[model samples]
Target: MVDTMALLLPFGRASRTTSPSAQHPAAGLPADDEVLLDAPDDRLGPALVAAGQGSHRAAADLLAATRALGRWDHRDRYVLRLAAFARSRPEWVQTWYAAAPDDPDVLLLRAQLAVDHAWGSPARAELLRGVSPLITAAARADDRDPVPWRLALDHARGSRAGHTYFGELWEAAVRRAPLHYGCHVAALRYLASSWHGSHRECLDFADRAAQDAPADSLVQALPARAALAYLNDGCGPGVPPERLHAA
Candidate 1:
């Protein structure tokens, strides 16, 4: 078997509980409004600005365009930014969700938001447990999209799920996008966590994934991420100098 477990990788809604500023809650957002997973695309910048101003149209349109174009990688990054925007400015997203309850973009954003919210809570595993259905619904919304499966892997890791379950998620992720960097990174984190201090196993998984993935694929840098992780934690044997050079 190809060790289906070798690959895997890994947002929330806005709420009205508190506002940084009643007039412009998102004022604290970056001056340039740079989003997480910053891609070079110019399209998303306008969408984020519009969302901050309480209009979901640009955000919705951008996500819709990404989905229509089958730009899964861009779609994934867009979802994270949109979800983060919602966290600070929930009203627009709530409106969007209410208007298009079943739109794949809407569903995916909602799932991302839920997971993001849950992950930050004091009760992480418990909060993540409740977000399971959202992730499932998002995954089912577009079976060909691996983004939801990526979220599922993150959820599984947050919930500290068993290997068998994560393996199933890993299979689903790679089946859709065999070398998705997000999923591969999630799997690496899981290995790092579950086998805590087992830097060799984590490096092994990362090296194999990086080797199998295309040169242009972000997955190719996964081994470097693993090396950095080991270096950061200063755990176990040092990553072989050869491996660092190869990465």
Candidate 2:
């Protein structure tokens, strides 16, 4: 597994009452992305269970996950929070991973989580059926090429074999575009599969996208390139082919 840089989340949300399931007042509540976004790791909110100090195992686990997410998305603080929660209670990984917004870590994360959860083909199918419309509507409305491309990449990586299966649509999704999301990730995957793209070629793709692609998309595409290098073919580091977030 690629060791993604730990993403430091803002903090855990506070409410007087904790859930019985969570074992603390902040238990079962969504994580605080805003807090993580507001400051660096040393400055993360105190509301989070002090390092090694949660009443419930879940709290500690969640704190760990958010801390893990500190370096990733500035926008999906909620997601970082969820990541912490999943680390605490791994069973929740699938549900929350699927919920991750279209961003750098989420797409690959959902897939890894789905695989970890053994979501199976049927589950993959169910998810694809649901997201297809959203894609269709988005494509019709948004002129931006990367949006749907991101969605397609999400579908391919995140599908379940049985429970969440979406069949060959994953492959088709990539082929249908105006080279949306560009082909960097796919290229990386192709290269990883058989060393298709030259290292310079992969870097060039990332360079073009970084300059022209939406700021948000650059995050997703970049990590995907990392996955291609590592997971797709077991090539390199946890870092994105291009490190956009840490910059």
Candidate 3:
């Protein structure tokens, strides 16, 4: 078998040799007052403001536009932001659902919200299992969208689903968007959870994914993400210092 670690070594060396300024010219720690955590973009800013004022039209239109344009990445980001907002203030989403019970955007938001809610419960696995229908509804709403499949991958992990089921979800997600970073991350997390003591497997998977992804694709960061997860796990066999650096 080809050595996955060998494949990742060059990337690791490049990362170490490259100056931080060359990689990210503007990279720096902002002042506490200047930092804006998870600030919405110009398009989303107005939608969120309107939602705060008891309006879901802007949010709906925004999501619809993303879908129409096949902007799955933007759609995924916006859905998460909207879902987070809804968790604290659900009136608008409830109103949206009542108005358009079958709207794809509404269904997507509902599924995300339900998963977020269930994720924090003590009975997390049980609650997550019950969320399958909502996820299915969202997935069915748009056969072309991969965000729902990404959500499903996460759902499967949280619900303690078997490898076969998770593999099926992975196939569906990649079929929609082969290089989708979100789906890749979801799959990575599932691997980490399922093979808790097998950090090498996770790293190998990450290396393979990064190898296949384009230079600018976010999936290129999968190896780094996997390394971080392994470090955080604390229970895995010690990964070599060079390998960690390369990842």
Instruction: Name the regions of candidate 1 deviating beyond 4 angstroms.
Output: 7-19, 22-40, 193-197
- Model 1 has a clash total of 11
Per-prediction TM-score, please? Answer: 0.84, 0.31, 0.82
lDDT of 3 by residue, 118-196 (tens): 9899999889988999999999999999999989988977887777677777878878888777787777776783443
Off by over 4 Å in 2: 1-20, 25-122, 156-228, 231-247
Q: What are the clash counts of all predictions, listed in order?
A: 11, 36, 1
Per-model lDDT: 0.76, 0.37, 0.77
Query: What shift in Å separates residue 179 of candidate 3 from its native position after superposition?
Result: 1.0
In order, what is each prediction's RMSD in angstroms?
Answer: 4.9, 13.2, 9.8
Q: Which regions of candidate 3 are displaced past 4 Å?
A: 1-37, 193-197
* Per-residue lDDT over 107-193 for candidate 1, one digit per residue giving the tens place of the 0 to 100 score: 999999999999899999888989999999998988888899889988988888888888999988888988776777778888884
Task: List model 2 lDDT by residue over 181-219, tens digit each.
Answer: 333343333323233334334444444444554665543
Measured on C-alpha atoms, candidate 2 has an lDDT of: 0.37
Instruction: In model 1, state the lDDT of residue 173.
Output: 87
lDDT, ranked from best to worst: 3, 1, 2
Query: Candidates ranked by TM-score, best first?
Result: 1, 3, 2
